[model samples]
Target: MQTDNSYANTFATDSDAELVLPSHPAQAREPQWLAFNAELAGQLGIPESLHTTAAGLGLYSGTELPDWIQPVALGYAGHQFANFVPRLGDGRALLLTEIIAPDGERFDLQLKGSGTTPFSRGGDGKAPLGPVMREFLVSEAMHALGVPTTRALAAVVTGDWVQRDEAQPGAIITRVAKSHLRIGTAQFVAHKITQGADESLRQAFADYVIARHYPLSKDRKHPYRALLRQIIDQQAHTVALWMSLGFVHGVMNTDNMTLSGETIDYGPCAFMENYDPNAVFSAIDRAGRYAYQNQPGIALWNLARLAEAWLPLLAKSGESQQQLIEAATELVHEFPIRYEAYYDQKMAFKLGLNSVTAETQALTRDWLSLLQDHALDYTQSFRQLADTLETNVEHFEKMQSWAAWQQRWHKLLTLQGDSDAVVSARMRQHNPAVIPRNHWVEAAIKQTVASGDLTIFNELTQVLRTPYDVVPLELSRYAEPAAPEKRVTRTFCGT
Candidate 1:
């Protein structure tokens, strides 16, 4: 497999590492089967020959690290559901190597559920089959839906079982991302500063992040502040897209928030069925802190944590400490405005508007209000809006609430001077015809675990690849919401 040992060559240390620790050797039990992502592997410049068999996959999940690969378990700190955890690192995940694509783009090739590392705390560092497959499906689905996310490269059955609640098959997912740097990574460096580490440590980590993800920052006058602004912008756009698709990330912990702006961890995440602003599906999120509507605010909060970590670095750049703090604080405060702008544009497109105005915003708000009041399916409501606009005139001449909303939408379209064809096309592009429904996901997981049948899993993956397209009527079952008895109300973390 193609590899770049740049990270190890640049950052390895004997005692006081800036970010990662030496990976503890752990064995993958009876590595039996492997599945490679041909598409993603090709994108990362992996030759077709390297990914065709179990041996190729073994290079990533195997007990022995190849000469070109140096596995390291990273260190970080995070606020979990608003509670600060001083240290939370790659407990069960390890960065194997960086892959340099033909086009010069670099990506991290990491293994989740590989085995325990020093940061594994007191728990066994292994992943069950169900969560592994969940990530494979959802991450691929998110990519297909045009959301920024960590893509899955391969999945392997380790021929072992992990006892979560009961003995379940253990598996490993090979995840690929632009980088693994997170807000918590910055927090870890900041914490080190308080523990008597010199400013050089923080600067080294920050420079590494800039080189890896934001190389352009090196050209800016205030590169550190520029990096912060760039990260904030990426996150703002990412969270807006998540909201547009009704995706609840479930856990918006600082550790899970990547500086690369990709959706990293997928544990307990779900798509909203009924349109409630406060929708949450994580089993552990009893307080609804990372609910659907709360995501933007929580993202800002996470970015604030990142800003806190970078303050010292910014101050060391010849700027007065207080000046740097005020500047960083101002940049963070721009997140809300940036998030709203992206969200407003997306909402306008969903409403089939050529332009967003005060009236359009009000109309969008009222439409959401209608959906929440009636507990309407979030995806279908917008997906069906274009159809409802035409059908209301023929079937519901009496003007029901939906029909009235349609009239207002049509008037707004007229005001914008966009033809029906133009507006309909815009709406279809923004609103998906289907999503990875919670119940369908649960059903697929149950079928795979209980019967070793991958029929449902394969079919669901295929359907979600073209989520915005109208599927065949025979496959319409995939688009439908869950039956009352089959609905999955809550989701759990893989750990």
Candidate 2:
């Protein structure tokens, strides 16, 4: 890896001292490399020599660190489910270092499941191999699908066991992100300010966020308000992309919500197969708070919490606190409008429309309603629709009310004056032919844990890299939805 001392502790400051604590990763008993994202490493200018050698394993697994590397555990607070917790930080992860890519993009290099920190909350900071694999695969898959997300750099076995129900093999994963700043981080600062800490802390943190993530906001008349709007726009677009791709981020807690608008935690996340809007896969979400269709609303809720955290800053120049609150509330309300626009545009593209209009929006909604009504596979339905446009095949012949919908769809394309071939090509570009199917992910993990084989895992990752492309014969199984008995109805937070 290239050295850039200037990028060290990019979020650190005297006022931010209390927000971060110096930490070191626990040494692994016998660290063994399991998976390394060579492609990502190359993109980030990480030399193959480093990753191929023991030096890479040691650095990534937290068994060792270079002198310039300053590892720290970030502190924050968050709302878990819907209840607010005043202190929830990086309990199992440390920001190892920051790397600047060849394209001049800065990224945080963090080690998850490395060891315990002050915020460990009396729990072991080790991650099981299953969640490690899940995050490594799914995060990369999300990146491949062109969604803004943190990417996995590597995974390794810690050569030590961690107890979670039964004794499970411990592992660690290296996560790369633009920054790990979250809504909880702001909440923590707000709490401090409320407790009569130096008001400068809030200003410093806000300045840092604007300078780093929302630099353009610094030029605005009301920079704090602009910052909130920009963050809302980013989150709305990101969550819309998640919904368009049938992704359900099971744990939509405030702490897991990144201010950078990147998808953070992959625990309990699953791609929706059957097109039920009420899908709930996270084992811990008994109430289905973060279900498939509830994501946009939950995202709005999280943004409200973020706005609340920024009350002091947003009110810095308002005529009255009530005025500032009202202003923030109005800004927060733009979330749904922006979310709906984004969702409509993406859904229209999936249905072979160049842009969203009233007609296109109606068509998209009707299509989703049909899918939900029939319990059809979400991803495959759109993919097969694209294929139907091209091949003129009766793939959806058994679907109820399909003939009527097809006639309407054809009429719209004919009205638009686009060739069926061109329309089909457009749809294929948006509707993915594959997703990181839950059953296959579990199967890959099962293989790795039972016999230490990575063939299935490697193959699945490859197929996910080109999700929108046509599936070749050998990789066809990856594109197929899981059989009835093999369906993975529940996903767990492997903490």
Candidate 3:
């Protein structure tokens, strides 16, 4: 990672105009990307500088790309969301390698839009610039806001065009993450139980996750059970964090779910504006299956498939897999309680409440009810909670529930012995004043394509980088949704 000043200096493109990608033939002139990954023999910490040398480009300036990418397309099976889809794997993506950081922790460098694979499923395996930048910006934003996510290492505009809806140029994003694999990968092997390689595959998958993520994940022979429990807890919080932030992950398929529990796929995803739990933004998500409120359920449903994959390992001699199934069932069933508790804690922090309890759930519900009535901006209300000193509710037209919630909030702070300053500080930490609102992003995208002027895009990126901070007045270009004339109801998946 480079210093902020240095990164800013490098981000400037006018002086180094030719150094950056320009408006040209995207399809023919695009660079053919090469993978830098871990080798099959478990060679680790391949310095990134080697990749720059191989690519023969200065896109990284003096920085380097990792060496020895043991690139492999992992095999997996998933339930799409809830309904079982028998076969699903790395259709078009590839997990390049695991980078062992200076601290000895590993993160995956997976390439999206690189090229097609055996699992192409009759679709072109390429990415456009818009979605590439979207993943980079939003993933980094999530990281800054204390959410675990795959970091975008770099975005390269492949000067090639990929035809989906329109003929658009292709690009590749080097996404660094805790891991590229999912429980679905494990399920892919487990579901083929009759193949006799089932047990071998399950053991290998468990070992891989433990070795890469939780070195201590397997202290005992049956640590798979423990590892499974740990993943359940992490995924619970991850989804709740997404919900708290008003994020709608257009596609929450099994293979898209990461084993390390970070928010992974960004295709066709959008941030909500007027906060509807049922809001569907993905052009492909005609049904509200993977909606905002539906995220947690979908997460658990995906986890269930993973659990089923682990059933063979859980089943012992002649007693049958149901014993293992019962144990797995218990773990999956715990998702709601974990989610609700985590959600309440997150919601409490958003509202500046320190001493939250079952009683406070009423106040929280009432606040959301008011939010729905007023169609308030979800991000704004929590961000403004601390700033507003009025005892009565006058921010919006409605006042009854707001007034009551405010009173309860004030009372809770007093009971918890916390000052207004402390509560405000806490609220600011949890509540982001701004997100990559759909309308603003769409406008920025249109502006870039229509005029090739990246001023609005760059400005929004700046605001998004510090999502928790208040946006400046000059940056108000990103503050609101597009009016009736500019609204984009559907977001496209840059396939």
Candidate 4:
């Protein structure tokens, strides 16, 4: 791997030393590649020779690195499941390096499940093969689905076992992201300043964040406040996309949310097969705190926490704490309105409406109610709806309420003066025929672990690459919902 690029070492050399702790990845005993994202590698201009070379495997698998490369475990604090943990950071992940693409975009190349860190917090830092595969498949699937998310670079299994419920095969996944900075990172610095650390630390950290993610904020009169507003807008857009796709993030803790606006943590996340607002798949989310419908609220709550972390920086020289709080609160309150605007626009297209209006909003509400009441598959129902529009097929004929909603949708399309074919085409563009279904993910993980068979895993990844396309006959099973007996009701963080 080439390490001499001009911008390759920017984060390592430029970020405030106080923000990151230098660390080393535990060398794997028998590192082996389980999967490599050749497409992503090509996009990054990685040499083809590096794809399967022993030296390349060592670098990505946390077994070996060039002497010049200095990995660090980032430090941050977060609210995990509404409880404020003052210090929670990258327990098993290490930032190996940063890559600046040929197009001038920068991405962090991090090795998750690498080894112990100062922030490991007494737990084993090794990740099991199951979660490694889970993140790799689901994150890549999210990218194909057009959800902003961190991409998987590679998957590797160390011929070592880590105890988690039982001894499981240890593994690592190379994650690619715009940046790994999170709201929790700011929270750490703000907390440090509150506890007698120099105020300049906060300023330095904030400036780094603005420079990396929101450079335009620097020109604003109140740059800190502008940064808060930008993060709020990003969270709104990302969460709205999640809602549109029936994805329950399962954990909306401030730490899991990225300043870059991409979905970061994939632990315990799942797609809702049945359109139930109360749907939650995380085994640990016992209270339904991060349910499918509750995601928007949780997103706003997390942003509020980020705003709280920025109070010191947001304050003017002579501003009182209360004044600063009120100012930040005002900006945080913009989240719901912004979220609704994004959600409505996406939903409008999903229903074959070219634009959102009061009429379309009302129609959407009823359509959701129908789905929830009938427990319709969230993804398939939309694809089926498009078919109904084109063929007058009455896919939901068995339900009495279906006819009324169908008639209303058809009439609205007619009044709006868009042809059925045109509207249906638009709907297909917005609604995907496939998602990373929990059962499929589980089966793939199980098969790979039990027998080292990647046939199912590889095929599933290929089908997900074109989720918006009509399902071909050979891939029909991938587009279908899980069978009742095979349904996976709960997902785990798999730390």
lDDT of the candidates, in the order given: 0.84, 0.88, 0.67, 0.86
Higher-ranked by TM-score: 2 or 4:
2
- lDDT string for model 2 (315-421, tens) is 75536878888888999999999999999999988999887788888888888888888888899999888778656645478778888888888888888889988
Better structure of 2 and 3 per TM-score: 2
Task: TM-score each candidate.
Answer: 0.95, 0.97, 0.85, 0.96
lDDT of 4 by residue, 240-299 (tens): 999999998988898999998999889999999989999989999999999898999888
Order the candidates by lDDT, highest first — what do you get?
2, 4, 1, 3
Candidate 3 displacement at residue 75 in angstroms: 2.3
Q: Going through the candidates in order, what is the number of backbone clashes in each?
A: 0, 0, 16, 0
Instruction: Order the candidate numbers by TM-score, best to worst.
Output: 2, 4, 1, 3
Q: Over 4 Å off in model 3, which ranges?
A: 1-28, 32-67, 81-83, 196-198, 316-320, 390-393, 397-400
* Candidate 1 residue-wise lDDT at 100: 83
Candidate 3: deviation at residue 312, Å? Answer: 1.9
Q: After superposition, how far is residue 59 of candidate 3 from its true place, in Å?
A: 9.2
Across 1-495, the per-residue lDDT of candidate 3 in tens digits comes to: 210111112212322111111111112254533222222113334345535454422232111233433344445667664666656555556665455655556666566776665555676667776787677667767776777788766556566777877877667777777666677666665665545542454676676677666666678666777777778888888888988888888889887788888888787788777757788888877788888888898888888887877776655566656676777798788888888888888888887776559867777887787777777778777777778743433575365566666667677778888777888888888898778777777666667556657776678777877777777988865766566676667887686
Error of 4 at 236 (Å): 0.4
Predicted candidate 1 versus true structure: per-residue lDDT over 1-495, tens digit per residue: 456866666666624644678785468767755456788888888876557565675665656555777788888899998888878889999898888898888899898998888789987888888888889889999999999999998887787889998899888888999989899988987887787777787888888889998999989998998898899999999999999999999999999999999998989999999888998899999999999999999999999999988886666556787887888889899999998999999999998986778988999898898888777788987887777645543323342476677678778888889877787888898898888898888888889788778888788888888888997786789899887788898998879
lDDT of candidate 2 at residue 56, scale 0 to 100: 92
Q: For model 3, where is the 10-residue window of minimal lDDT? A: 17-26
Show where candidate 2 strays beyond 4 Å.
Answer: 1-17, 316-318, 392-395
